[model samples]
Each structure stands twice: as C-alpha cells, then as structure tokens.
Target: MGDNIHLDYKYLSSLFSSVESITFEQYIINQKIEHAKELMVYDEFSLSEIAFKMNYRSVA
Candidate 1:
C-alpha cells in the first residue's frame, strides 16, 4: 500500500495509526473480516473458501 502511494512503509504505518488509532495490520484484518461477512451474505463461497481467500491460516 505504501508502495502504491510512494511513501515508505514505516512512515505510512505511522500516519495510519495516528489518524485511525489502529495499526495498519489490524485495519487490514478488520477489512478482510468485513469482506468475508459480505461474501457469506451472498452465499457464493463456503467457509473454508472464504478463509483461504482472506489468507487466514485456518478455517477456525
């Protein structure tokens, strides 16, 4: 994400945390979980498939 915006990663993370009050990694996980919930509503993929698509280490 920083590369796309042409900022150093450390700087970007600092800025993000300052503005959002959450670390960038945690923000990403929240987004992925929200997207997974949306996908579940659509019912197009199984739980394991959603976990895999979200890069989770396990379905649990």
Candidate 2:
C-alpha cells in the first residue's frame, strides 16, 4: 500500500482537514494506537511485539 500510495505531507494535511487540532502524523499515530488496542485483545501477542509489528521505533 505504501508503494502504491505517495503520501505527500500536503496531501495528508488536506486529507485530515477536519482534525484541525492535530497534525497528520499525530492523527496516524492515534489511529495506530487504536488499532494496537484492538489487537491487544488477543492475548497471544505482547505489547512490545505489537508495537514492533506496528513499526514503532521503541516499544517503550
């Protein structure tokens, strides 16, 4: 999906026009955290593992 989509900053800014209080990257991080919460419900995965799967630089 990343290869197919060119995520330009200006385009992302326009895409998240309704979230005026937050930057696009922050919005994405929030979304990722939400998804991580959903994934966390599955007990087979640890938070550190999920963080890595979500491409976080540090699990802390």
Candidate 3:
C-alpha cells in the first residue's frame, strides 16, 4: 500500500502508528478479525474457509 503511494513502508507505518496509536500490521489484523466475525455472523462460510479468506496459513 505504501509502495502505491510512493512512500517507504517503514515511514508509512510510523506515521500510521503516530496517528492511530497502533501499528499498521496490528490494524490490519484487527480489521481481518472483525471481518471474520462478520462472516461468521452471516453463517455463510466454515471456519477453515474464513481463515483462508483472511489469508491465515491455517485454521489453527
């Protein structure tokens, strides 16, 4: 994403952390977790499917 914006990833992450009080990676994980919960509520996918969709290596 930072590459698309022509900024170094480390710099972008630092800026994001300064403004959001959380690391950019953590923010992405939080978003993925929230999306997984929403998908679970809809009952449209299995746990494994959700994990895969969220880019987790495994359902573990």
Query: What's the number of clashes in each of the models?
Result: 0, 0, 0
lDDT of 3 by residue, 1-60 (tens): 787779998898899999999999999989999999999999999999999999999988
How large is the C-alpha RMSD of every model relative to the true structure? 1.7, 3.9, 1.3
User: Alpha carbon lDDT of residue 1, candidate 2?
Assistant: 24
List, residue by residue over 1-60, the lDDT tens digit for candidate 2.
Answer: 234577876766776766677877788889999999888987678888898989998878
Give the winner by TM-score: 1 or 2. 1
Which residue pairs does candidate 1 place in steric collision?
none
Candidate 3 lDDT trough over 10 residues, lowest sum: 1-10
Candidate 2 TM-score, true structure as reference:
0.60
Q: All candidates' lDDT scores?
A: 0.93, 0.80, 0.94
Clashing pairs in 3: none
Off by over 4 Å in 2: 1-8, 11-15, 18-21
Residue range with the least summed lDDT across 10 consecutive positions in model 1? 1-10
Each prediction's TM-score versus the true structure? 0.80, 0.60, 0.84
